[model samples]
Target: MRQPREKIFITCAVTGNLTKPEQTPYLPITPQQIADASLEAADAGAAIVHIHVRDPHTGNPSMELDYYRDAVEQIRGKNRDLILNLTTGPGGRFVPSHDNPRIAGPGTTLIAPERRVEHIAALKPDICTLDLNTMNSGGEVVINTPQNIRRMAKIIRESGVKPEIELFDSGDIALMHALLDDGTLQGPVLCSLVTGVRYGFQPSPETVIYARNLLPPNTEFTAIGVGRASFTMVAHSYLAGGHVRVGLEDAVYLSRGQLAKSNAAMVEKAKRIVEDLGGQIATPLETRDIIGLPQPAR
Candidate 1:
């Protein structure tokens, strides 16, 4: 008997937590810009829009509730069907002062676990990220203790939002298991393997396979590779029966040296790759079903 092929869930991370306008001119900042990019990505075959808000004035990463509210409202106004997945991954960066190790620098943004997930609980997004491990994010430390994750997960679950467990390294899988055991996270689980971040898992075929093995039984997962490995990792993930995520948030380049003009451009390229590899892209409704999100009331 032949089995039907699995559909691919295409998630577009419209903007990230780290990249600034100085790094790439195309990064979306204002609520309008983020909404426009998200709509464009949805139109180009993205099933889910993974979002992170930036300061409207400075274009820096922001955990402000108003920023998230504005971005979500604007995006829903334009495209009611696009699934919104807000990031609760911010407010956990710890950067020590160069001059004195004990002195925290301005870069540190650590907050209470409940406080970090407050926006998601208030806004009630369909999905939100719960980064599962503490790692050296670039030069700064990204601290996600087991207690923090459990606390945040409980809040997310109570809000009726699915938690997209984000694993930066293989060891984080064990942390996820703990969440499942403690009843903080529910199944069937959805995980995203993040690669190419400094001091995290490197993007490679072997790494993807190893990470997949560590996931809970019958869990749905995706892989995203930052910088130059974006496209390559997408191809690898697709071939391995996992989904793929891409956008300016992960990589600004369409190729080795060419910069992507918009989030839609990245989605278009990802669609071509998925089609060429004999996979079908999941529609917005299918993605909602897979991730346990209700249809938009709008």
Candidate 2:
């Protein structure tokens, strides 16, 4: 039986690669905006911030080293204790051409695995996401073969950053166990069970318990609800012995027909939900201790 988490930590995913600029006027775009949004979320009781940079002018996802550096530096300057979890999920989406499916399509961003983690090596944040799902994502397919995953894992490990395995389905959890057995990923790992994405894990209580049961012993997991199910999973995740995550990356609306003004607003709501369930929100310093992350030297 999965026990409830008395003390939980909320991770605010400030910006994501898939969320479009036109989705909401308040989504953070530039490095400064991203940093400011992260700080605001932390102030709203989010212990960690999951970040993905965007091109300031184009508002598209960017893997540029400078963009990451600028966003990371700005956040570190203001808040030293807020855990930073950067994304290496870009450079893996494959949009196959209609004429020749093997040929890359316009939206395909596939690249050498090392190139994907270049930013991770350059800027070693406290944590970075290592996606393991190779499922269909809308019109495109995400390709994360075991070989490529190992290559990227090597770089993330070498950088001294923890990889929060993003598991979209039960098979991904199996892959996680394989990596642990081979020593590619260490044990007592940290991961996120992302739910509510179409063609991925469905958002439901049964789905949460099934996936949570598959994880290895003592593994720290967060049950993330994307889209409309975002806040609902905050309570679900907490009751299932896991953490919770929410932000513009997951959902834009605070309620039906009402758009969230900022990432801070979403965090504030998630904080309220967890507390109403008799759960305590962990601070960044406390989160580090709970997750076994050491504070970085100043």
Candidate 3:
């Protein structure tokens, strides 16, 4: 008899930080909306929900502890078993003044390294993103120096929360390894290959394969293709023995002109695709076990 195929972890990025509702009407902003979207995704076979809280009033990205707390509480109240992966990738954007570069502009929000992961450390989510490299992120500069990453990694490790190292480009794989070598990150490091962003790695099968090859042995990883590359990359990642992430945080449309009503819809589509390809979807408990997340409290 043939052996059964391994079940793949399905992570849903419920709401991205920067993308506004103007881009897509389906984006979830308020705490209740986030919680509702996450619950739906969990029902649709997503083992984990990768979250980013937005300003309740303005719909802008926010790192406020209150927002994170409210969102986490709401989701946990409903789905106790769903894994929540909070984001620490905020507080690092730098957009200099065009005329006078000396003074920082309004777009700059660079905070101290310790402040970056403050929410995650306090909330104690199952996982939090640890963006390892500094890069020109689209029109803005996402400054993540080696020193800051070390400091942030130390905090994340000490907090007992797994860090989902985000690699926007191939070079970040090397930086991730360095974090592991310096004892800042522990074993079974989880990675996310982000593609189709303005200045990050472009979405392509070859690029995904190349990036995956560079990861350390025994690493668990996933792939996210932003915007138009979403579905294609999901299919590619599944084929390459990696996990998948989908939802409004990555792509808002079901097709070129169609809008996704919720994160659950996106997960449903991914589930269909994965099943058609002979793969099984992972449950929240299985995902927690795979990623070494702390079990839900009784």
Selected candidate, larger lDDT, 1 vs 2: 2
Model 1: residues >4 Å from true position, as ranges? 1-5
Model 1 lDDT tens row, 1-298: 1122378889999989876688788989988899889999999999999999888999988888998899899887777778899999988888999999777898899889999999998999888989987987777888988888888888888898988989999789988887788777888899999989878899998998888888887788888999999999888888877888999889999997888999999999998998898889999988887767787775
Write the residue-wise lDDT of candidate 2 on 88-128 in tens digits: 99999999899999899899999999999998999889999
Candidate with best TM-score = 2
lDDT of 1 at 297: 76
TM per candidate comes to 0.95, 0.99, 0.96
User: Which residue pairs overlap in candidate 1's backbone?
Assistant: none
True lDDT of residue 196, candidate 2: 95
Cα distance off (Å), candidate 3, residue 245: 0.4
Which model, 2 or 3, shows the larger TM-score?
2
**Candidate 2 residue pairs in backbone clash:** none
